[model samples]
Target chain A: MSHIRIDNLTKVYMGRRSRPRNIHDPEEHFGDNILVLNDITLGFEEGEMVCILGPSGCGKSTLLRIIAGFEPPTNGTVRVGGQVVSAPSDQSIFVFQQGGLFPWMTVYENVGLGLRHIRDAATKHERIQEYVEMVELEAFEDYYPHQLSGGMQRRVELARALAVNPDLLIMDEPFSGLDFLTHMKMREEVVNMHEFLRKTTLVVTHDIDDALIMGDRIVVLSGRPSAVKLMHALNFPRPRDFEKNPGLSRLRSEIFLMLGVPYAV
Target chain B: MKQHNDGEPTMKDNPEQAPDSGNRSLRLGLLSLLVIILLWEVLARGTGWSVHIFPDPLTVVFSFVELLRDGTLLRHTVASLFRVTAGFYLAVCLGVPIGIVLGRSVNARSLFNPIIQFLRPISPLAWIPLAMLWFGIGDPPAIFLIFLASFFPMVVSTTIAVQNINPTYFQVAANFRFSYQETLTRLILPAIIPDVVTALRMTVTIAWLVVVAAEMIAVQSGLGYLILDARNALRMDYVMNGMIVIGVIGLLLDNIMKRLGDVESSKWGIQAR
Candidate 1:
């Protein structure tokens, strides 16, 4: 069964006028109305890891936000677990690009923030510790976000989301800021977590390699007023090692070709 | 690699070269104070001004000691401190929650903003007559004046702080399925603590100013009253002495509030400096 469904999503951004005229006409001063997402329709199956890939301003993040219920669509419906999403729901957690850990909170506290709503203290503690240990962040639990490196902060954010045990995890370019080595290490950690948790996930990224490495299925989105260009179901097996995986390079080239960007060896 | 217990890098591996930075700041501060005092002493001795008009720092210190010996200074200081504390606490208790509500709710803010703006421009001293008329020249009137002085700024600053918080924090709270009250208590309150602390420090200073001004008009037993009495008697030395006392006490109270704010902010890792 499909765990998440997005149908006919449309978002139009109305721009304001630069100057006011003596006669007021509502449409005259509406400088330029740009459509960001045009009738985007897609679905993800239960326990599947899906990546939405496109260039910047391709509305990939906008579509993810719609699915997360962070933003309302101009026209469409988003269903999670067979229920319509009107606003941000507890069933899905969205991880942002910049590792949005609250700077004021210690890492343990940051990870535990979502669990504060859980009335059962024992369960909250167990859940927090479980995810913290999963992310290998148990030692840095007391450190503040400012004290952590970008990669570590992202790990904390991931742990925070996982601790909530949501039905779906949504990530928007979660590893774009990290150095190459750190990004690779984080990818491995995420893959490991996904395999263990088996929770449905949707990730949006511009990096084709990341799409190939992390996604179970890749959905390429076309530029502004976006729509899905292609959806490829990867046949890579579990515990797949990136260094040893031959299909990654082939898939990367295919994605590059689909995106109409020059393919690099 | 020098690592923290958390396996992160630490600054301890390479010793900081400017190890004497703390000592340097302390020495410079003390030197500045000494220079100011020396200049004051020279002006007092060299000018044709009467010692009564502008007493040397030493004379002021001597008079301070004499007042201390007589216990009048302590009594007045305590009385002023008590008034300021009572008024400030009342303002905070009433102001912060009202501010938070106003900040969070647009209707509440719109309703109260006009009245607050109307009242804010009126000086604390201007409230003296009404306070006297309402409470009849006692501690109540004095405290009321101070409350009028401190409440608006505290409430305004707090409201602004709560309103201006990063929307991302609110989104996070909502994503976590927090109840509205839970969002306010757990996320919003903690996020605004730094701003609240800053406003609180400002409130204390304003309260100090208001209490002194209130004492001059509404009370017969505070530091301000001592200054008024000295002036009435034409004892300029005692007047200078009372002014000095007010200055020193105000500085001490401000320092204490600042240190308390520092401690509170540090716990949240949001310390200003």
Candidate 2:
């Protein structure tokens, strides 16, 4: 069994009010089911990093949210470490695209939030310190989220997720709106942290550069009513320069082909 | 000019700006007060107004000095402030937690919204006769009437604030598996503090306003009583003095609340500093 298994997962959001119940079979709506995910099955091996790539509004985030236990699948099962997932647990944490950080909390407080639940006070301070330094926010431990720049806030989110030290880390477009310089720097830090820690990770992003830079394996998802359109194992080494490499260029084109948009560069 | 393009201004970049603005504001306020006083003095003389009807600024000033000398002004002011404080504090204690429930729970909102709407429009002064009958001419009735005046707005503002908080914070709290207490202390409460403080400022003013009216009916030691008593004695100067004192104290109270908001860390965070 894979470390994480999403088996025949299908999600149908009730877009509008349903008709009166007694008139027809309830399953009739299944045909018109605004299917966001369609019987998709995927797996992530332990100690591996996978990036689910697709165009915007392609249900990639919905899939990630489902796997993170934030949403329920209409007809499927998600198994993490051979346990059927029910509710969001401390085993995994989702880092939102917009950095869903607590604005009121100082850096130390936000990073140490997860530890407050488990009541392991002895190592809580030390682990929070370690994660804070890992994300290079040592001097900002007392600052609120609003005081930090966008990039700095996102780093705090990363440190917060890492401080929990979960078996799985899921991120949704973690670098979407960042400037070019900050984007480059953040991607490097993310990959560095992943390499050093080697936790099972899944990232969902539309940006091909982010997928290429951090993904050990990339899964391409199609447009609305999405399914796994393509999956490719990337055998690239650490610090892989996709900007200068022909193989990475070819791989980027492949993703574009899967997304049905032509690769320009 | 150089810092405009960067969009982030530090104290080092704008060394003397804050104090300069504060200084200008103080100068402007003092100038406005002087202009108003001069206008009042001139208008009374120019109109040949009776001193009984419109006490000139000099007469009002003399009345103020007499009140101070007799300790009546201090005692009345303290009594008014105490009533406002008691009522405002009681309103806060009763309103905030209930507001949270009403904001977060549909059932609680359904239960309370109609009752609040009904009680809200009835003026605190309308309760004056009933208050006088029930509490029998003491500080308690005035305080109760002030609390009634303060309660509705505090509840409404706090409920709106809590409801306006982004759903994302709750999701973050859930993501960490936070306990109910943790969610309240760490997430919900902090997010609503700015709104609660703003509500407090509004309610304190309401409480202050109502205490004057309440004191006029049921109490005998506050500025409101002083106004009523002076009017009966036909001491227009003393009545004018009481009005002036109330206005000045209200302004001072507003500034204190403004300072409370200005110095808050949560307030800074809400502005996305």
User: Which lDDT values do the candidates have, in the order given?
Assistant: 0.82, 0.85
Least well predicted 10-residue stretch by lDDT in candidate 2 chain B: B3-12
What is candidate 1's CA lDDT for residue B188?
Answer: 76
Which number leads on lDDT?
2
lDDT tens per residue, model 2, A1-265: 7999999999887745555344464333543446688889998889888999987887898898888888888999999999988788778899988849887788989899888855677778888999899888998898888889889999999999988889899988888899999988998888888899999999998888789879998999877778888888888876788676889988888777777778646
> What are the fnat scores of the candidates, in the order listed?
0.49, 0.62
TM-score of each: 0.86, 0.91
User: Which RMSD does model 1 reach against the true structure?
Assistant: 6.6
Off by over 4 Å in 1: A14-33, A117-123, A237-251, A257-260, A263-265, B1-27, B264-267, B270-273
Residues B6-63 of candidate 1 have per-residue lDDT tens digits of 2222234324534455545565677798999999999998996877677888887887
Tell me the number of clashing residue pairs for each predicted model.
Answer: 0, 0
Q: After superposition, how far is residue A230 of candidate 1 from its true place, in Å?
A: 1.8
| CAPRI rating of model 1 | acceptable
